[model samples]
Target: MSSGNPTVFRTLNERVALTLLLEHGGLTRAELEQHTGLSKASAAEVLRRLENSGLARKAGLKPGNAGPAAQMWQLDGSAALVAGVDLTTTSIEVSVADLTGRVLGVHTTDATGDVRRLLGETLDAAGFGLDELDQVVVGVPGVVEADGRRVRQAVQLSGWSGLDDLPENVRLENDVNLVAIRELQEHEDSSFVLFWVGGGVGAGVVLDGGLWRGVTGRGGEVGSVIVPDPVTNGRRYGQDGGPLGALLGAEPLAALAEAHGL
Candidate 1:
């Protein structure tokens, strides 16, 4: 399957090479050719373009006893700065990282505080500034609705209106879906379900190599599930449930534990 366009092919080759270098830390010309299925000349051209773009650089020579010394190319970690935010009901945790996924700095603040301000503070701690951040990913415990503009059914992130006036580089996502992303590497299966249980319960459904966020972004509202439990009648979170975790969130769990004298 050829793109039949030289420019497109070149871009694809460069992206593949970058992913290889990022995953392997560094790779020689031959190693890249082997992994990317690119010819020696094509791999060399890709690496040259990556270097020119400042996305990659020659790290050093590979430890080999055969032939000429092969140059090991690595991703330029300083090429871009990115931020990840873990936003919860009470607290927000921000971490600034580079292209190679190295944590540059971290900052924590109350959820009620301004997230943009917290991001600025985190970037400052990383020896950078808000202007230098190329992108930011926020993981919120809620159903990202309205094309990711409005967060609805967030039983957790209540009262806070959120930083809706974010720049184009900022993105909001469901936290449990992000957690389910890790399962892809753990299993080769294209479909699996990851259950997030702690403060709340949610499902991360991966289908056909992607997280199914659903049309309305309520794909995995497991915490709202209802099941029957004959033992507990008055303690139900709502009507119509059968031993479900909807009534077993953090507060309810604590209440149940205290009632058990544990």
Candidate 2:
């Protein structure tokens, strides 16, 4: 089925070609056509557009099985850059990567003062200016909204809020959700629950081969689960002092251990 729009079709073809090059590292026009099912002319046009846009470039030549060598095309790694920021109560960690997902640099700094300024400084330490970054992904300890535009709750980093004043391409995600993503990538299991026991308690759940963020993006907010107060054993604990935090969080655990003379 065709969209009946030439511009749309051309854009789709370019995207398909780019995807092939990114996944395989390099590909000839024939290989792109074979993998993407695009016509020879369509594939050539897509490649031309990608080249003109500085997203793809000719790498080298690949000897064909029966013919002369073919030109190998690949993604332009230096065309764009991305940064990942891990925001914690004590420090801010930043990692810069090129378009091909190669880590260019990594830096860490104290998490004091304005977050935007700290981000700029961290990027500078990574040998790139803030303006040079194409995108920024910020992982914060909180319940991020579905649209990733707001941070609803972050008990540890109380001074920080959403990425309102940052660049439009900056994304805010829950730190626990990021952990779940990393776990899913590293392990073979399709489903599991990751418990985060630190200054605050939280959880990330992967179900059916995907991170299960509930309808309101609160699926794995284990820290907010209310239970009987440890002191009174009658009333439910408040949101800040829930059962999970009281049992597994650092301060509470330390206090418990001290009380037992450990």
Candidate 3:
């Protein structure tokens, strides 16, 4: 006997089938039924809804052992576009990719202003529109707090009022942390630590195949460790040069290079 409404069950089944397609890339009706534990007719209905909704599309056919070729279905990669935004004190870069992680386009600009406005312009230059992005991950020079709802300690972005005005799909993350995530993607199932030196000094901690951001996402703030100031032989506190940041950050490095005429 039927317990819940058929429509709700149908929707749920469609979601399950879509998820399977996403995970496995492509699947035939029989394979979908085998993975989902759904009968033939139910699987067919789910596939039908997915096709009608444009969430899945036919991708040739799969050969079976005994029967004729079965129709293969896969998630439409173009159904959702993802954007990665990197905002620094001097530049804004936007990269667009498809659901399958294929980079569609990238645009970099020296302009700095409202994030949304810059995002729109960058997307346009990247051969896409702001409306096409289903998700946007922003990397800023700061520690993300409150599960990415807030960002702190981004002195380079002082002129920036934060991402509060951006849409919910736009998430804030630390710059070096984003680089760490990129490393994790390239080297899966590994534990490693990444140190980044730029306009600032920061680190990213990857532990047991995952990023171990501390309670407030400040786990990699190596720049604030209070290293001894070589110039003063004492604690350096003012002019933003007292912290470890001033000792090893980009400005100090540049000064060293200029002093040596390098």
Candidate 4:
């Protein structure tokens, strides 16, 4: 999908072209011109601009194709750095990836009552200093307010409120919401809901190709839906640690399993 159209030469044009190239891999100037339906000159100009910005580069010649082998332009996927952190009650996953969504390094550790220490160590292990990060996104298990300041109702996490003290520029999001975001962005599919039944059940909804966090950002709490609990005299929900984990904690699951069978 070459972006050959004039596209007004605004920031959006560059973004669109870059996205096209990244998604489709390499494309020759002529191919871009054809795919984007832009004049050859326009395509060349955009390609040049992207190359200058260190966002795109020539990736050798097109191979085994019919027409004359042309220089293929590809996204300079390693040019910039972005970090993503998935924090849950059970574990934390930290990764540094490029603009092309390629993970350069990753670290996963137990979420043992200290997310900050784990975050620092993971960043170090992933070979990314705080300075190198152009953007930081933290996805945690809780309801993230629109301002992204408050972590409301993170019952499992001990220091949920301390997230406000993180690097001021970092973006905070619900882990389930992040999953839905990744699903929608990576696949571009609409009308989907990601139900992550881990440590605790969580969900994120995507409608019409966009994330629907709702007015309060607590849109995904499928586990909270009431169900019968004879022992409690009220409705109950499965606990976190996923279904099995919810059904049986370190203490109860063992007893139930032993009593039932092997």
Give the per-residue lDDT digits (tens) of candidate 3, residues 1-262.
7598988888788888877887788999999999999999989888888888878889998888998999999988887899999899987999899876679999998977777888888889999987778888889888787467667667788766636777777788898988999889778889999999888888999998888988866888888786655554443564434667777866666765766688
lDDT of 2 by residue, 145-246 (tens): 777777777777866543556777678898888888988866755899998876677889999779888887888887767655454344345544456666
Lowest-sum lDDT 10-residue window in model 1:
229-238
The residue pairs found clashing in candidate 4 are 2-36, 4-36, 4-38, 5-38, 198-242, 199-240, 199-241, 199-242, 200-240
Question: How does residue 131 of candidate 1 score in lDDT?
Answer: 76
| lDDT winner | 3
* RMSD of each candidate relative to the true structure: 3.0, 4.5, 5.5, 5.4
Query: What would the per-residue lDDT of candidate 4 be over residues 30-76, giving only the tens digit for each residue?
Result: 88877778888878888999999999998999864576788899999
In candidate 3, which residue pairs get closer than 3 Å at backbone N, Cα or C atoms, i.e. clash?
Answer: 236-242
My TM-score estimates for the predictions, one after another, are: 0.86, 0.78, 0.70, 0.78
Deviating ranges (above 4 Å) for candidate 3: 1-53, 63-67, 186-190, 228-244, 250-262
lDDT of each: 0.77, 0.82, 0.83, 0.75
lDDT of 1: 0.77
Highest TM-score: which candidate? 1
Q: Rank the candidates by TM-score, best first.
A: 1, 4, 2, 3
Candidate 1, residue 38: Cα displacement in angstroms equals: 1.0
